[model samples]
Target: MTPEQVMNIAYQGMRVTLLLGGPLLITALATGLLVSLFQAATQINEMTLSFIPKILAVFAVLVLTGPWLLKLITNYTIELFSNIPAMIT
Candidate 1:
């Protein structure tokens, strides 16, 4: 394959990865920030308190977005595999 084709494939793979992971990561980040602010305000410096909320929030996010995430990854994988013959020499 040409360099351009390789770059295109890599870029698409990265885009798919980001799309698949972005929601969970963003949910975790937001949950962590909120938990931190709450801890600061309440002076509840317990480690488990912070950990539990983030875990719950991430789980909720996964539950809510699981179907869409699965569909996205499935579509990407199908597309990539379908294009393999074209990508080959």
Candidate 2:
């Protein structure tokens, strides 16, 4: 495979990875921040509060977006696998 083809494959793989992971991570981060703020305001500094909220929010997001996420991943995988012969040449 040429350098250009290799870079293209790497770039596409990275894009797929980020797309798959970004939403869940972003939701978790937002949930954590909101929970932290709430805990601070209420003076309820429970050490585990933030973690639970983040986990729940991330799980909820995954459930809601699962089909779409799966479709995207499947498409990316098919595209990559289909290109194997072209890439090798």
Candidate 3:
């Protein structure tokens, strides 16, 4: 494969990775921020206080988005695999 083709594939892989991970990361970030704000407002400074909510939020996000995320990744993988023979020659 040419350098350009390799780079293109790498770029696509990164894009796919980011797309797959973006929601969970964003959810965690938002949850953490909200938890922090709540802690500040209520003066409850327990270190573990943030863990459960963030976990639940991420879990909920995963539950909600899992199928769509799976379909997206599966389609990308199928497309990449389908092009393998062409890429080889």
Candidate 4:
């Protein structure tokens, strides 16, 4: 394949990867920030306090977005597979 085609494929793969991972990562980050703020305000100072909430938030996002995420990855895989012959040429 041409360099342009290879780059395009790599770009698409990264885009899909980010799309797939962005939600969970963002959820965890937001959750952690909120938990930290709460801990600070309450003077809790418990390092492990944020873990559960972060996990729960990420899990909730994953659960809520699971179907859409699945469909997205499935579609991307299908499209990539379908384009394989063209890519080969």
Predicted model with the maximum TM-score = 3
Q: Lowest-lDDT window of 10 residues in candidate 4?
A: 39-48
Best by lDDT: 3
Per-residue lDDT tens digits of candidate 1, residues 1-89? 89999999899899989998999999989998999999999999988887888889999999999999999989999999998998896
lDDT of 4 at 6: 93
Model with the higher lDDT, candidate 1 or 3: 3
- Per-candidate TM-scores read 0.94, 0.94, 0.96, 0.95
> How far out, in Å, is residue 77 in model 4?
0.8
Return the clash pairs for model 2, or none: none
Give me candidate 3's TM-score against the actual structure: 0.96
**lDDT minimum window of 10 residues, candidate 3:** 1-10
RMSD, every candidate, angstroms: 0.9, 0.9, 0.7, 0.8
Query: Global lDDT of each model?
Result: 0.92, 0.90, 0.97, 0.94
Taking all chains together, the TM-score of candidate 4 against the true structure is 0.95
Model 1 stretches with alpha carbons more than 4 Å out: none
- Runs of candidate 3 with Cα error greater than 4 angstroms are none
**Model 4, range 14-60, lDDT digits (tens) per residue?**
99999999999999999999999999899999888999999899999
lDDT of 2 by residue, 1-89 (tens): 89999899889889989989999999988998899889889999798879878888899999999999999999999998998888877
Candidate 3 lDDT for residue 3: 93
